[model samples]
Target: MNSTGRRARILVTVIAGVLLAALATATVLIARRNADPAPGGGADPVAAASPGAGRPGGPGLRVLSNGLLSTVSLADPAGPRTVTEQHCDRAYTAGGTTACLTPAGALSAPRLLVLDEGLRVKRSVSLAGLPNRTRVSPDGRMAGWTLFVGGDSYAGGGFSTRTGILDTRTGEVIGSLEEFAVFRDGKRYRAADINVWGVTFAADSNRFYATVSSGGVRSLAEGDVAARTLRTLADNVECPSLSPDGTRIAFKQAVGADPGKGWRLTVYDLATGRRTESAETRSVDDQAAWLDDRTLAYGLQRGDGTNDVWTVPADGGGEPRVLVQGANSPAVLPAAR
Candidate 1:
């Protein structure tokens, strides 16, 4: 064929191939967007309900799991609506919203996933370092999490833990507590002193607390939420739970020298600074929740990984009653609207 005719034919072939490829890509994207189930069928109704299914004032527990954050109504605990699904290790809720911490991956650095009440990913904040044990402030204005820097030898994983507070609105690092000393009643406590975990904030967001164990001695720290200042309340403790009134704290304690043998649930009066053990069963790794100023809720694990939820009186009386199964991290709603 003539040179000009051959060149024209070659150009036409290339253009047709490009158009075909573009059409195929578009088709795949359209299919993926519509693949999400609609209402009805075996799909979860709560999740199928628009992106804004659960609003700010709704009755549900927002939980983070395997990088996906979802909400389950307290009334219907099993009905969960996945709001955000990313590769995250943990999730927490504050101020009627949810936040997730992404795990380190090949292509992406660790980040914070913030979601609205409707289970929609609203924003993503890149974190400078790896984060662990994340908690949100009660006011929803601030978020705090522990960051693990260089490696150290701790039983769980690392020795050095740095706590950072971030401004949720601006995504700024507002405060951090890196000092390795434990201060109690205006005195510097030693670092080799306590094993801390389960860090959380009070209702007012003014104070933060954690479960600390030292040389068989266990206690709770009532620290300045903003300044990171700390003061010890009591010792010989396990998982600690704060009451809604902020006037009391509940925890589990080892009844004998060998805590691994088992533990007993206890309550502490913040005002009087007294620790009282309950008549509850002896269990390890138990967590307690305050249903109210007088009522407490907790979970007990059986020989199997399955667990039973129970409730007792904060005043150290009454028999332990069952609440639910496979339930953990119970935060009672405000009497249900």
Candidate 2:
């Protein structure tokens, strides 16, 4: 062949290589998108309710009843056996250990009580000067809550709110947050009362996040546990629960004119800061706790105060499946010892 013929062949080869590279890229992209978990995969079933249905369970599963926060051993398929009775808004158990809320009406304060497998209170910590929201860390080593202090009744109704952390081991106050601003009506308003609730901590316990509700406005706040500085993470969010991996937070979003109406469950990606609502959830009242990195458990109430426990996927696809009926303040045991 002549020189020109040789050059033409080379060019043809280069073009073929580029085409193959493009095809390979496209194939990889398709694979990633396919592997992506369905948007709210396990979550969808929980939202769709059917008659005579109950929540799915796994080995060693246990439920802490809401009204009394009673401990029931689910391992016995016959029925849930009561291990203890302690009226708590929330309960968490890990490695045969449990922690719950004991109304500290005695001190005119609420206390978080940690218990062992034998149903004995190991420790009781006072929350007298804190805000209404409280939660214990995943490891059950630390407790976090919100506090409102030093505000006139006019600054967003003159209530002062702050976030606080307590050292469960020593019963010491580790950190507190008081700096926060409330946004409303296209204007930002400053307030002494931050009113943070729905407290959850990252797996590493390095960062903490909570919902700040004030003057009919709700926003998520994140705090650096070491530095003790609080900043708003997202606005118009409530009932925030951190993923087990600490990469995302599951929460409920309000819809329609009334805040209570059109409430939906949504998960916010912490790394990307993108939010997605469950297609299955029509209306949810409050609370979404992570069953795992991929699954979320929460409570939903109909018109009446009666509620049910349900679980959904974080990526969003499957309908919600009821875990239990007439149960509120649902808490999951930490993934195995």
Candidate 3:
């Protein structure tokens, strides 16, 4: 062959090699993308595109997608969440009421919001301290919230919580449960060091349960709203959440009655007066919600301060499982509760 013909063959060979290398690189990239690990442990669901801010939330599992109010389907708890524009440090919904606790700022105090199903704020009450937990009564006629009123950390044993309730139907606010008279040991209980948190209401709205701490001891107190009274039921019970059936209450019991040692998720039978520890075996500093009468769901913080929701059996039988990733303050809606 002549010199010109040899040069043309060399140019074609170099072009073919370049195309082959590009094709191989593209294939490897696609494979790596497909194999990417999920957010926590299980498979991460592909997040749905943001529907923009302030979308209405309906029936499903209500959660905080980051700090915004969001919802995920109960049929698919680990699926993509539908985020909203509303921001809250904690949130809950049931019956027809949706309660949200807004994050506090340097210049502004935290606020509690009662939003409609369309994500519109119906009523808002300015609150003091950091937003901690909130719950709506089964009948949706009442709402309650807990705030870190004093100290910096709960585990440090210097913290105090203020829990309050609202009569949503009458627009009457019980600013703090402290105003209610509580009886201990069959006598009137009044103490300067009383602190209350984690209010969970029964189906009747007038009855509820909470963790009442006074003089360094915490007990589960059953409160009567009309009478403005509280009756101590059990000791070492913190953050009580009533089950749908009214037969059991789930709470985080301080491990060995010591706050520094962590807590065990426990369920108390109202009739039998028996407490059953859950299988989670991890410290859950949260007010658990019932996913029906048999299962309970609560938040567990990752090492980085991010959160993932986990579920365990109420009867203390099954192992713990991750229900939703990057979410907290779970509320199962009308269909279940």
What is the TM-score (0 to 1) of candidate 3?
0.81
Mark the regions of model 2 whose C-alpha exceeds 4 Å error after superposition. 1-62, 71-79, 94-97, 104-109, 128-133, 146-163, 174-176, 179-190, 213-217, 256-262, 302-304, 334-337
Provide C-alpha RMSD values for all models, in order.
9.0, 24.0, 14.0
- Comparing candidate 2 with candidate 3, which one achieves the higher TM-score? 3
Local distance difference test scores for all models: 0.59, 0.59, 0.83
In candidate 1, how many Å is residue 172 off? 3.8
TM-scores of all candidate predictions against the true structure: 0.63, 0.65, 0.81
lDDT of 3 by residue, 1-337 (tens): 9999999999999999999998998888767544432212233222332322122243468888788778787777766667866678999988767888877653456878876554556677878988898999987889999999888555667787788898878989899999899899889999988888899999999999998898778999999999999999889999999999998999999898988899999999988889999998999899999988899999999999889889999999999999989999998864422
Please give the lDDT score at residue 291 for candidate 2: 62
lDDT of 2 by residue, 128-214 (tens): 443344566777666665544555221234465555666656666654455433444445657644566667877566577877765
Residue 42's C-alpha lDDT in candidate 3?
32
TM-score of 1: 0.63
Clashing residue pair totals per candidate (backbone < 3 A): 4, 37, 1
Whole-structure CA lDDT of model 3: 0.83
Model 1 misplacement above 4 A: 1-58, 62-91, 101-112, 122-134, 146-164, 174-181, 190-195, 212-216, 284-287, 307-310, 333-337
